[model samples]
Target: MEQRVDRVEQRQDRLEDIVATMGELLIETREMVVEMRRENRQTRRIWIAIARKQELFDDDEFQDVFGDE
Candidate 1:
């Protein structure tokens, strides 16, 4: 009976350790997702800037009507 209790206690301790590790991993995953969202936002801003500049290039009347302005 004592040996059985000891085995159960050891298993409970190991389970607690696994739970702690899973919690840490969850926190890390959340942080990584937040960082990726931030990077995606920055990338979208750059794309918008590029598209605006492209519109200017596509507008030939922009130069003919407002030359060197």
Candidate 2:
């Protein structure tokens, strides 16, 4: 009976550790996704600015392609 209780307690402790680790991973994954989205937005803005500077499209055409900034 004592051995069974010890085994159960050990398992409970291990499960707690695994849950904590998973929570940390979930938070880290969310942060990474946020950072990636921010970087993508910045990259898109830079490309649009370059295209406009190079006059890749006329005003109306640019509007049609990219919409209003």
Question: Number of clashing residue pairs in every model?
Answer: 0, 0
Q: Cα RMSDs of all predictions?
A: 8.6, 1.6
TM, every model: 0.77, 0.82
Error of 1 at 68 (Å): 30
Q: Which stretches of candidate 2 lie over 4 Å from their true place?
A: none
For candidate 2, write residues 1-69 as lDDT tens digits: 999999999999999999999999999999999999999999989988999899999999889878887
Candidates in order have lDDT scores of 0.80, 0.94
Write one digit per residue (lDDT tens) for candidate 1, span 1-69: 999999999999999999999999999999999999999989866765675577755456655644444
In Å, residue 41's CA in model 2 sits off its true spot by 0.7
The best candidate in terms of lDDT: 2
Model 1: lDDT to the true structure: 0.80
Minimal lDDT window, size 10, model 1: 60-69
